[model samples]
Target chain A: MMDFLTNDLLLLSDSAVRNAIPLLLACLAGLYSERAGIFDIGLEGKMLVAAFAAGAFSAIAGMPAYDGGWEMGAWSVWIGLGAAIIASTIFSMIHAFASITLRGNQLISGVAINFFAAGITVLIGQHWFRMGGQTPQLREGQRFEPISLPFAESLKDVPIVGDIYYQLISGHNIIVYFGFIIVALTWWVLYRTRFGLRMRAVGENPGAVDTAGISVVKLRYSALIITGILCGLAGAYLSLGTAAAGFGKDMTAGRGFIALAALIFAKWKPISAMGATLLFGMLEAIGNKYQTLDLGFVVLPGQFMQALPYILTVVILAGFVGKAIPPKAGGEPYVKER
Target chain B: MNKNLPKWVDLGLIPLLTLLLAFAVSGLVVLSIGQDPVEVVQVMIKGAFNPFGIGHTLYFTTSFIFTGLAVAVAFHARLFNIGGEGQAGIAGVGVALVMLSYDWPHWSIALLVGTLAALAFGAAWAAIPAYLQAKRGSHIVITTIMFNLIATAIIGYLVVGPMQGEGSQPQSERFPASASLPDFHEIFGWFGLEFAKHAPANISFFIALVAALLVWILIWKTRLGYEMRAFGHSEKAAVYAGISPLKITMIAMLISGALSGLMAVNTVQGEAERLLLGSVEGAGFIGIAVALMGRSHPVGVLLAAFLFGILTQGGAELQFELGIPAQMITVIQALIIMFTGSLENLVRMPMEKIFIRAGKGATS
Candidate 1:
């Protein structure tokens, strides 16, 4: 069974795994703030801002190759990564202030963030870059490169199942490997750590966490900053690490919300989120492959194929996979009495 | 000191701030591009609101009114109808296709039929999210956003595909003369302007005004409106009062959809008389800002919509005269939305006295 499945679906599955990495990274970013009860729905905007910053910064670094040097090229990627993190952090702070300090509607704040990000990025991109976006593209040598596993070439000579690991595990960018590591790391931080426990406590019962002498504001800020960093990486991966060569307005698309759906579908568990992202990735990869399959008279419009995940997301939320509950204080902004 | 203030004081303050901010931001952008900021503002002002600018302002306001109301109606039910632009665009195409493909006798009758068709199209477009929210218990915010994306793609394909215009651009064929809305300046001759002769403002403006008044009456003086407000104030309270959340949601979305469809009527049967992707642009989302600024009141929405209309025209004029981007108005408009939305959430009570009086001054 494994042999047959591997032979037929290995390439598609490999591509699905690659696609899911960035989405999984984004979901973890959402999970961080959400588990701490912040409901960072502006994940989409944050990713866009980061992508713009990363792409432009990397490009400015003179297309420096990743040869481990402190040259202008090295400074460029470093600056790009730094800018991506800072931009997303600043963007997330808007959400934090609106959802946390002002006690405004979290959803409205998120919408505002989405609008502001899109407007400002595109406006800046068009006016300043003369590129019609927030920034310019990264030069090829400055972008992140794919890392192949050792012995995978030789392992492909083995029997049916051997082809699966060789293809799926080996044929991915370096960021995909980090994305898998992030999943494991996130699971560890969420389940086995004190901070994770307190985050869950605050999300489920802020009053109880407050009663237990934890600073709800401090915990939430930390969660969001971590989320900011993760989201930056996701954006970077999307623009510089994936097939995309540059940034575009709303380039994150609705992947942020899809990741949110994945977060919910996984019941907020990091490991489950990884699995759910992979499943969604599989859906996308299979959809792409299915377009080429001539079912004759059953050729689905490619638009519908692109919209499949959203349709499924609506279905899942509607009880196709039963009810998925959010954090108790999901969108509530905590106001400190002192 | 004068004691009596204007009834529209609250509405006036935000647009003023928005204007100031927009000019300031545009000035900065101009400076960055090595242009004199002050000169640019002067040009923009001249272009958008000079004696010849009334026609475009009046025509644009006609559609703005419906899109703004579409958003405002949903806010009453606490639903974020961000798909207003997409809905308007889709319905505009629907009406344009029908009117262009089949000839109709009277322009008014064509408008009426096209508007009804647009309403159906808008409702179906909105129903995707409404159904998810009603039956699946999915969050409307996320689902509606998803719909906006899909709608954009669908509209893009249609305009560039089966419904593609005869011209090379991605636009539909112009509506027949019999199907178009009557020119307002020719029909009413109320707002006297020499520019009206160049490009006439039409009857759609008055229709939008009537729609605003109707929405006002519906919201303040009707049972359904009361139920919607109740839902907005407290979903649980509404449910306790025997109102089904699902039913109200569906109704709210449908009304919002229809309002957006009316805006499409102005686009297809009024002035533009053709369909183009993003022609409606972000007006629907901008309606959310208008609704917020108006406090979701019908009269407030009307006043706010007009203010936006004026700014939009003025901003364009500034660009034509100044060589600055006309979209500077958008920045100022967005800034106003941000600050006003924050202002709406600010606590009214004095904090110092309360904190001093009670150690536990945590409550709103």
Candidate 2:
């Protein structure tokens, strides 16, 4: 019973980290955009489009040489990642133009972006691949392969510490490590850097930032660019880094919204965002592990587990769990004083 | 800055121009895909207006009407009710529960109770988000999005577990024959008019029309509507005048949610005769596009809903005839939303400039 429990713990923790990477990246992406007073509900859309771009480009680049076909090197994944970043950044620019330049409703602009991504990805995917809106299955050389740490194999039999290090802390694709690095980078950028300070100030008081000789539009645009790049990484992770062969239609599902929930649960803090996403990820891991988990007294349904993150977000938003105050000028477009 | 143009410019001309821009962009997309834009349009119109296709078009129009009205009602109070999708989905379960409870003796009685069930369930789904927004200052958009996901999980659990049919599908058993709503074929047959036998359009279409009429009256002809509009315009000003923001928010959302719920009567009780998973099929999101393009007016919503209904039915035909994906419609819908909802200023600014110049020339 003890051995089985330990084994289950290792497996669960391993999957939890894997699942949390995309959410973490997206959550941090939201952090950058929302901090700059550009509320982005389109994170899911950006990630989805990026996923499609990455999958499609990588599949094309990695296609083997035939009578007339061109073969590419294993560096195809980098090309795919670059395509994802470029596509997502262009998509984010649309939101920036609508919400910033046109001074339109930010929420409505975000909604449009989401719908646009959802539609365009599938339309282009089907047009290119003709696989019913799915990219071709990526092979080993075409996708991100997991990298085992140097001591992971030797450390596997070294009792609890070694097992924990081997199972929970090692053998992940490069993006997973990048996700953690981004959490740290995000913390540094949001709290430490001068640009970060101005970005936060813009979200809280664009008028003040404008008065202080900073261009609110430039700050907001730059913030959204960062948001776009991070979302692209998250999307690439979903398609190229994960076990899934390639991008499928609507594959981002609701992770964007879930990341938004995590952002709120963290009260816009970076470290807490990690914790919140990990908790949600663990819930997802548990749900995937058991169809219906049987306890001594009651059986917990998987649906309940799946719904818990959303329920918790509502509770937090309602101040039952805790108060979640957003940035003051979060959803409003800035107009210069007349 | 120019406010000298007639109301028709704002109401009619701007939306028309915006729609044209959206269609132009969509045409470019189609052209990029190697399909002739003119041919695509021809096929779409023929497919949506043919005798057999008109019924499906009207059927789609009925649901769009309800969801569109739902979003429009909330828009009056400045509340973005994104939870229409979830509210409608949960309402399907409520409708199934009521229709499956017992053998009702008549279709009229079942229809009445089923509508009430839909209204109650949809309102209940919206209630939490509304309450949070009212009392706690939570952002309604985020909360509604979360509720949509949760509602999906709840419906998935119910349909697969307790509500599963014997045929191994994740759907409930069909409601009793007596509980089925009258289709357009039967209703038109009573008047000696031959309608398509398999068209899904039904008496629920009439319900949607009635709902639209009632919404018009409620929004334009009532004291509550005045207060809701006051709150929507400016919360600070409304509060100074003793209009309660909380009251307006809650009432507007409840009404909005009920309208969304009413859509289930068309899909679950009228067309499918059973509660199927994914019955809403993104109609809730489509409501946002409808409301935006309609300028949040009931009559405008009706027209927009009909237009979207044609796009939907026509897109299905495009898929069948031209090998183009049905998502082509979604792309068009998204463009419309972006242009009409978010980028209205793009056309409005230029048009306002032109109109101002024209008005000045006449005066000079």
Candidate 3:
């Protein structure tokens, strides 16, 4: 009985791990900027832009050789990822400028960014790619390949839990493991370091931080920039690592908000944020799993199941698990009076 | 600095600059893709205003006006109600169910039922956040957005599952004839205006107009409106003034949600006879922009909604005539809104100076 339970959990482990990476990376990205008192609501827009850029670049890189151009698909994927990071980073600057400098409302700026990204990406794809706003599929070697653990075979027949080890250990993309490491690194940087302390100080009371010789604006800007880079990587993973293609309209699909919820639920702490992300991941996994298993009873339609995470978010937010407070001065922009 | 600039120039600057920037950016994309940007604009304008075009634009605007008002009402109370899409949608379902079941003669009954459903559902949707704010102090913005997602999923499931229409398109069945509003385009066509023959302009537009006016009166000339505005300014002060933030939020959200339901009537009663999977795409979200541009006031909202309605209708015309994707409207709308919402900050320096001068005058 113990062996069966262990095997089942092991089998589910890979899916859970795969599901958690995107949210984990995004929440960390959000944690960095928001921790420093700047609200980065444009994470969704940043992700969508990067995903499209990476997909288009990869497609171009892998396209059939024409006009004496080198037919180098692998090189294009790398370049595409790099371009995605740059493109998203540039887009993040708009939010930075609006909130950090002009002190505009962060929510409005973020929503506008979301609309702008969705519209432009769809328009460009339909007008250019001619695939009805979808990018061409990348050829093998052009997309990130799943890495299987070789040692899993050696451990498969050792004991009652050996099969569990094999299923849980093998056949996941490279980015999944890296995403976990990033979460840990993010937690360490957010809680255990001098920078984290300053960020917290800036968020709670930027005026105080400023009085103590820290440039509140500079810290916020740096945090936003860091967020930009992380969001780019998360977007790349969505298209390049998981689905391995171009994006659809609203592709980030409010995942940025989900990450934000995770951020708040964890009380702006990176490690707790990981816990929150996993809880979300578990929701998503169960939603997907329930679609396949009728469980001897009628289930709600897939659409309802799909909305489960968002509903759970609302419920949790509405005191289902008590309340989650944001960084004290999150939405309010700092305006130093001359 | 000289005060030679026109009073309207300050307002005009943000809109004009936004247009210029959007066009410039779109022009770059057009140039890169080997399409003439000027040609695209010309096509859009021609498609938008050619007599036959205005009717369709009006038809689309009827719905936007309601959604815009819904967002604007909540804005007055300083609440974010992103459930406009869901509220409008669920209310649409409510209308569909009523039409499918009832045999009423007066369209008023159906309209009442639909509107009430929208208000009830929208209020319920928003109540989650209100309760959180009252009890646990959660931000309404974040919770409302999450509600939007849940609303989308729930509505999507309903249409595809229990509410599936006779057609295979994962939609609701055709609403009964009694439920539909009178089509005005047909009346105009009887006067030899062939331009109105194809458009779906109906009595719903007039209803929407009256609704907007009524909203204006309720917001500006009423005691409740004063309390709402006060709540928006400061919750602590509002509480001190004996205004219950919780009650105001709930009332505002219900009114907002009801207005969003009217959006369904515009579509189900006037244009489409049934509800589709993605009926009220982003009107709820765009209404935030409308409210912002309109400054959450009724008159401002109407103008903003009309302008956006024209753009939307024009984009649909472009899709039919020039084969351009309708998504361009989204980009343009986003650009316009982003610039407009940020315009207050842009003119803050000048406003401050003016205020300072006014203060000096009073002192002197």
Candidate 4:
């Protein structure tokens, strides 16, 4: 057991953190929208559109044999990232339009958005590439490359500390590093700024904001836009970051939904969102690592571990760990006259 | 929005108009891909209505009816049952076990036990989320969706590990012949007419019709349903009237789950004759659209299910005949739901204004 925990688990922990990046970004994405009283369940939808956009842009711009194509380069990843953000923004705007402007049932609107994304991505991708809804694999230099820290090679043999720095922290895609920075920035912007306070107030009591002469619609729209940005980054990272294996149909693979669970699991706080994401991601990585690993006692099913996060969400919501309260005005469209 | 002079326009005209607009937009999309929209429409209509295609259309309709009723019942109670997919999927296991374990002499006896088992399993799956929402204040929508994913993992394990057929395929053995539901062709053959040959449309079609009728009677004629509707309209008022929110929430979701589970009888026993992975497809998701378009009424649900059946069967022909992608059908379905539910006010507001103008004209 000691041998199993030290070496095998350390490697598991490293990949766990790497997998945690997209989940963390997605949870943070949901933080802003729900904070402003707009219950956006379209996180999955937004991410899919972005991933498809990123993949299509990269495949189009950097394909080696395409007509008049430039050699694949780092700029392709940047262009892909930009395309993802723009595409996700447009998709989220439709959600904003229905949930906000139309004052429709937020849940129904969200379900529609999810379907729209799944269909549109596959439809367009197959039409463009003739590759059964798969984007061409990115060549070297066309995707994010793993970066090395100053002493990563030298620190490799220094026991636990070495693994922590060299294996876990260093040599990750640049997006993983940026994911952490975004988490901190999200926490700061949410807790430290005047805008954050007002946004939280809108979720709690949109009536008070409207009475105070603030534009509830405008505040909510901006909140959703921020949500779009984070969701876009998560999607782009899935397709273009160093961890990427190119985009395929439904490649986000319900990570967005898992992130939503983490958002509520974190009690809607940004820092807790990060912790929750990492914990969930670690659960997944461990699940993959311990496939039918037999102990002296009884063998465990890997799927049980893979399903831990969702089970925990259900357990948490069932009041085992106290109430998981959402924003007070969530799922309700703000109507001034009412 | 509810204070309208004409009930017909509210329930009938708006959905029709929005459906037309949805199709117009879909036509434009098809046009963008250089396919002729007129030809597409013609092909879809012909494919869906042709004798051969009608069997498949009705088979899809059978599945949709159960799911639609599942959603409609829950929607009436102000609860969204998004886990119908998982509920139906889980129900497949129960259905398979019932048929495989029993050496029943007749199809009817096997179907009876299988149907009950499916309901029990689906309701058992839904009971957790309902309990969480009723007792612990968890949002039903998110919790149900989460259950959907959990159901996938469970069925994955069941099909692969515990219930795997001797064959390498990740499916159970084909169901016993005595347990298999009779096809439409067999039934029609008794009367000397050739119909739905080799198609999977079965006795479940009549059962679906009966289920819709039962839903109508239950919602309109039962005291329990009154309390559910009362609670949905105003929980505070229902509490004052001595109705229990906890009781209603659990009961509503359980019934909803049973209805969704019934869809499995059509797909697993009636059609596939075995428990296949991904057997539920996306019918549960489409149930939301049917419920919305049906206005959560049984009659409306039936009509909407049929309309969806046309689109599904017809969309297949469109793909096979014209090389148009099947995703176009999904896009159209999404647009229909979005337009009917989310942008309903867009159609309603204008229509309401027209009715108001006409009312004033008639009076003045």
Candidate that scores best on TM-score? 2
Worst 10 residues of 2 chain A by lDDT: A64-73
lDDT of 3 by residue, A1-338 (tens): 77556755555555666667778888888898888777766778888888887777777777777723247856866766786788788877888888888888787888888778887877777776787777777767566777877787888887755676677666677777777788788877777888878988898898899888889888888888888887888777777777645656667777777787777777778788788888777666766665634556764555665676666666666666766656788888897856
List, residue by residue over B170-235, the lDDT tens digit for candidate 4. Answer: 788788899988899998998998896889899888989998998888888999989889988999
Q: What 10-residue stretch in candidate 1 chain A is worst by lDDT? A: A62-71
Considering only N, C-alpha and C atoms within 3 Å, which residue pairs clash in candidate 1? Answer: A125-A133, A125-A134, A318-B136, B43-B318, B44-B317, B44-B318, B47-B317, B48-B317, B184-B201, B184-B202
Native contacts kept (model 2): 0.74
Candidate 2: C-alpha lDDT:
0.91
DockQ of each: 0.32, 0.81, 0.65, 0.71
lDDT of 1 at B357: 47
Put the candidates in TM-score order, highest first. Answer: 2, 4, 3, 1
Candidate number achieving the greatest DockQ relative to the actual structure: 2
Q: Judge candidate 4 at residue B79 and give its lDDT.
A: 93
Instruction: List TM-scores for all candidates, in order.
Output: 0.86, 0.98, 0.91, 0.97
Docking class of 4: medium
Candidate 1 residues B1-364, lDDT tens each?
A: 0123233333454345544554465467567666676676566555546556767776667677888898888888888887787788778877877898888999878877887888888887888788778777777876776677667767766777777778788877777788877675567554553334545467777878888988887788999999998998899999999999989999999889888877877766676777777777777777877777677877878877877777778777765564445445666665556655643344212332333345344432
lDDT of 3 at A94: 84
Q: Rate the local accuracy (lDDT) of all candidates.
A: 0.74, 0.91, 0.74, 0.87
Between candidates 2 and 4, the one scoring higher on TM-score is 2
Residue runs of model 4 more than 4 Å from their true location after superposition: A1-6, A64-72, A242-244, A293-298, B361-364
